[model samples]
Target: MARKIGLYGILAYVVYGLFFYWYLFYFADSSLQFEYEGSKADPATFLNGRELMLTEEYSKIRNLLFFLSTPFEWLFYLFILLLGFGNAFKKWAENSSKFKFVRTAIYLFWLSLFAFIATTPLNYISYSLSKSYNISTQSFSSWMKDELIDFWINFGMMIIIVAVLYWLINKSRKRWWLYAWLLSVPFTLFMMFLQPVVIDPLYNDFYPLKNKELETKILNLADKAGIPAEHVFEVNMAEKTNALNAYVNGIGSNSRIVLWDTTLNRLSDDQILFIMAHEMAHYVEKHIYFGIAGYLLLSLVGLYLTAKLMEYVIGKWGNALRIPAVNDIRSLPLFLMILSMLLFISSPLSNFVSRYQESRADHYAIEMTQNTEAAIGTFQELTRAGLSQVNPPLLVKIFRYGHPTMLERISMLEDYEINNKAKTNE
Candidate 1:
């Protein structure tokens, strides 16, 4: 078992290295090495009513708060380490032996509640900071309602997953990881399909964009990109957030290009078109399907590593932790801890792939729109409005940033402009 674990670890490491090299060297824009001319002398000159100082301060503080919150988030694992989760799970298991499914559901409820309570303070603090910074517009009560809804949704999902996972573990202790990984693929896809329709509407109202003219413009861009323009939808997000954002989500019948009302209100038609083009590029380039494939691949590797690590930990410390076997519900915390740690360590690789995909979308956006000015302005406005860090530290970028730094994105646009001009001259 140890030999197999070591062999799997080595193979995973080598695969990750190759993937890293490919994404960094081939997939990503190597031209990210351009000179940034720095922020415009007058932020208002680029966009009306923009203040650089205030925006920069907001960006810095928002980023700092997020960075500091990481360790606080990790405290849940610490609670688990101290046998808090194990004891709760054991107690729940003892009390609800009448029905296996009901017992699992109760265990899940307790576990989810434990995590929610453990993390709520930090979550509230983050929310408060966002509100203070004018990023959040939702009132406290509304926000709490959303949080509770989210908790229950997650709890509902976890109960079924826990039941399935433990069943697999009991049936085939040695091959449970393989079965679990396979199960995750369909479950993830189903959730993705449901999220845009069933889940998202729980929090906010989505409508066919109210701006008919802008909708026409975006649909035209979508048509140019050879994607279904009818899939474009707008979320009534201004009631909850002042942040400007848009994204393409889901796959097949569930797929949609969603723009925030805040985004439509704040950005110009050209800028909105640029953003729509970026989102369209995700589908036009088949990134939605490709992303799911990448996720499944990583899950396969992660689950295998998790199973190996969980076995070793149980063998060594089961007596002390009171964890009898992998199938035992009380051992969930330890299993989760190992999986979380592995995923954390592997995040750089994941982030690299994500950054590469985003860069491709950026490239497609530029090509599809042929409006470098709008692309540049969109980033500048988003940086100011979203309080996004234009330049983050190297380690932070590798581990945390799913997209390139705002500065890196701006630099890529500049590179695109220069190349486009040279091509025109030729």
Candidate 2:
């Protein structure tokens, strides 16, 4: 039965992949083409013929990869469990170590290593696609170096989390999920605090913004926005990708605005200021805190659901899965599978909340900067640089987009401009 189930899982993933590939490459281009009826924002007005074609092709491939990778991950975990690899690793760890912590480290090292190997093909596909499209500026060796760094950092973090989780489970089987959720709140915050200072620098160089004149202008805007930012930092992302991005990261003392070198090089001073204004809006409106609160609430519910599902699945299929109990270390893959499925199912809800916050930030940016042309120009340049779909399909918007589409943003800015002009005439 276990072998049959595993075979079915593989077949399902293969079938889905073929269908998704066909839909994206063969059928989706014509079907997903969005036409603008609004007077303000039109694709043709911004993107040239070649640009339009490139964006469509690039967006399709990216969407295809994004949708397929999650299911592929699910299949990978199912394969590991059904093949008895999970139990085999657990046994190996036991024989290798007398201490529980050491045993856990050994078990997780193997699991993380295999998971990394399984996912590398998809990761490489993404990298190769980016290179072909002129998006990535990274060499193969540099990319692999970053990939190794990510693997080790993630493995270390996983060890810490899994150790705490299993310890909680042993202490109180019935209430471990609740306790885990409680502990995760602080741990999540600590990671966020550390991310800006510690983890980020490992991947790219970060220092204060070089253009001191532009920095002062940004600081003036920050002062007006009531953000207590003392300095702006710039990251050297040109070495990796041609993408332009900026964000406000961390909490409290770590909180500051960061820009990509690509952004400073590619955009005008006014446009960069508008981008800065948008990022500052995230801080001023407390979106970071709100996001954290929303995450904690959802995780509380998700953990509760995951605990119930894990108990039921292990109770029924313990022998088939080779997981003796919910609390067994070998059951980690099952736990992760259930949690991944839940997270995938809930993506639309989380994405909706994110879009709302992003739209609010757009409104704040326009109100603060009062430069509709700069805002519109910035959005156009961003789309061109990233080759982003200005108007994606409805399903993609719901499942993938966290911000308003390029069309929506440009239209909003145009509307804002018209309203302000009418008020001035009055």
> Which model scores highest in TM-score?
2
Every model's TM-score: 0.86, 0.97
lDDT leader: 2
**Clash number for every model?**
0, 0
* Whole-model lDDT values for every prediction: 0.77, 0.90
In model 1, which runs have C-alpha deviations exceeding 4 angstroms? Answer: 1-35, 38-61, 64-74, 422-426
Off by over 4 Å in 2: 26-40
Per-residue C-alpha lDDT of model 1 across residues 1-426, encoded as one tens digit per residue: 434443554565556555544443345431223334334312444544445555555655554555445444444554564545667676777697888888888877777788888878878988988898888999999999999999999888888888999999999999999999988988998999999999999998888878888888888887777887584688999989988999988777888889998998889999998888888888887888888898899889999998998899888866655677878888777676677777777889989998998999998888888898988888888877776556655655887799987776877888888898999999
lDDT value, residue 339 of candidate 2: 91
TM-score of model number 1? 0.86
Evaluated at residue 202, the lDDT of candidate 1 is 95
Tell me how far the alpha carbon of residue 354 in candidate 2 is from the true structure, in angstroms, after superposition: 0.6
